[model samples]
Target: MSAPQIVSGLAEIADRYDAVLCDIWGVIHNGRESFRDACVALARFQAERGPVILISNAPRPSPAVIEQLDGLGVQREAYARVVTSGDATRALLAERAPGPAFKLGPDRDDPLYEGTGVTFAPLEEARFIACTGPFDDETEEPNDYRERFEGAVARGLEMICANPDIVVQRGDKLIYCAGALAQLYEILGGKVEMAGKPFRAVYDICLEEAASRTKTPLDRSRVLCIGDGLPTDIRGANAQELDVLFVASGIHEAETLDAGGAIRAEAVESLLRQEGLKANWAMPDLVW
Candidate 1:
């Protein structure tokens, strides 16, 4: 009901939360390199607060995500632990064990199936679909999977959408993700199960991990969710009734900023209203 508070850094509201559930891509990194300031902010939060968990919609397991983060120059001290959609999706798979699943992502994401007890099967022989994203996001789009999804739908295969993010910024380019494909399949009357942000599963893992490390029961009201995505990160936090600090310079920057690259505060309010999103505060970038 009130206009979102605009701030310059996390310090402005750092004392309000004991833990931080932070997004990976777009918030801390751009898929190519880590944002030093963002990483520093997380480290600072962990030092002062209870814990900081890097939550992501990446379809790979946490270890795999960590390896990638290390390669991307993300420091180990940035956060206490990482929680990923892949971990939540694997849990879902464990409940439906001993089934042949058709994996619809790149070979690099194979770690998602490491210990899930799911057999890899061809589409025709599979019981369900596990969608991470395209094999090559740089060149593929959701339409590229039209025929594949159509065939799967005809066979009544439900999809497990590992990443609930529709698209993410990769450096300077925007690439489609599993959510876009899942949405397309649903549009064509296919059933989908989501397991990332905007959904509660990943958040549950993050909160649990934070509490375990802190060795204290965490109050949801004392946690802060930091991200740049409206549909996934921001919406998910709002649904869980958690306060959020939104970074407006990521995916929605172009749409929320003036032609001169300044953030249009009124436009931001209108956009949040249109999308039915709520954030306690907003900043162009993460700094502390």
Candidate 2:
């Protein structure tokens, strides 16, 4: 494929695609607040074009995530529907119900387990591990779990990761996510399972829902996937054979943007190439 063209705004290519699969964090918001322009652009697209479906890796179910989105200033009309890894994970958790699993992650992530029938237990009495992220992402790191993971590995407990993002932008800072712990678990000879981005589970849910909303069969060629995450967003889109619009000013901005704050096409290309990935378009930030 050719190098991505740096786009000034979404309007440049809005007409080329029929629907958009957009990322929530970093694209429309940074955990602390919303990106007004990006939100407006999506609202406009939904008004003039086709459905704008949000595909997020957040550990909370879609309905619960809406509360967070509302607090962050994201409008309800910005998209047709929202699909998340947490939504996809409920099935995996349900299949293993009454597991007495060791539930990890913060209280906010508790919504992910409701009605899944999976009961929680202390590590010593647990049969498996369900991790959404560190109990306190602001203060914990992956290494902090090494001691606990060693014991879990000895028991051969499989960890089900709700979110596959290693890190996410929280305001101006980056914080650890469930995938970070999953990464560490794998290194310690433990098994990990995830159904988030870069995995077909979440995409399948998102696409199926998008198709249902459009009342027409989905066409891969006319769908656009937008996100700032390389491993999750870009890789997942590539696997589904969908085009990508890389958000240069998101989490990877430190490396993809130059001194003058312009998106460096060469740098973006080099970064994606290094990861054996490609995006059809790149923009400093999402705008109308």
Candidate 3:
């Protein structure tokens, strides 16, 4: 793996890529407010590049989150298309619809099952588990579901994880996601299926949409991915053989930034080394 070039802004290397695959939650917004500079950078890229596809591990379909984006001040013109983990996982749920799944995660994520013909039941009567995240993320952890999940596992119930992210930055703190529970489930001898980042389902949708938006042949080599999550974003990009730009100001800020919120190149490299990961480029934050 090559050392990541610490660039100041996306413009420094914008000309090399034909399209952009940008992550949400961390790179553009933090679930509290929009990062205006990051949003501006992506909008500019969409105007100059082939397409700016907002690929996210958000547990709801792209449309479901549009209103949240609007409320958070993320401009609609920032990107051409938005594909999310929920969009990809909906098909999985549809395939096993009416199975009387025990839907996990918060009530806010109920949009994931709309129109999918899937039915929900209490844990005892459910045939499978569909996890979006903690039912009460602010106060819950994976251990809260250990007893519940153990029973499901003994019944051979498979868990379909919508978001393959263990945790994500929500404001200034990290909160558990569906992947955290999925990890715990697997530890207890349960099977889990995921369609989000670091998985092929989400990428296939992103690239297919990118191709439709472009006028020419899609050059996968020339597409750049911008994100913060090491496992979901960077690892997914690497698996697809795509160049990735790591945003240091997100969840790994403690390891990649200093007290003054400035990028520490050495710390960033060290963190990457510890994870056995490599990025083509990295930045403190996404700015043009």
Q: Write the per-residue lDDT of candidate 3 for residues 74-138, one digit (tens) a residue.
A: 88779888999999999999999988999998888999999999999999999889999999999
lDDT of model number 2: 0.93
Candidate 1 RMSD computed on C-alpha atoms after optimal superposition onto the true structure: 1.3
lDDT, candidate 2, at 273: 93
Tens digits of per-residue lDDT, candidate 1, 1-288, equal 666788888988998988999999998899998899998888888887769899999998899999989999989988999999998888888766667889898998888888779887899999998889998999999999899999999999999888989999999999999999999999999999988898998888898888887766888899999999999999999999999898888999997766776667777788788889888988888888
lDDT per model vs. reference: 0.89, 0.93, 0.92
Q: Write the per-residue lDDT of candidate 2 for residues 59-177, one digit (tens) a residue.
A: 88999888888998899889999999999999999999999999999999999999999999999899999999999999999999999999999999999999999999999999999
Model 3: lDDT equals: 0.92
TM-score of each: 0.96, 0.98, 0.98
Model 2 lDDT at residue 2: 79
lDDT of 1: 0.89
**Considering lDDT, where higher is better, how would the candidates rank from best to worst?**
2, 3, 1
Stretches of candidate 1 off by over 4 Å are 259-261
Candidate 3 local Cα displacement, residue 161, angstroms: 0.6
Model 1 clashing residue pairs (backbone): none
Off by over 4 Å in 2: none
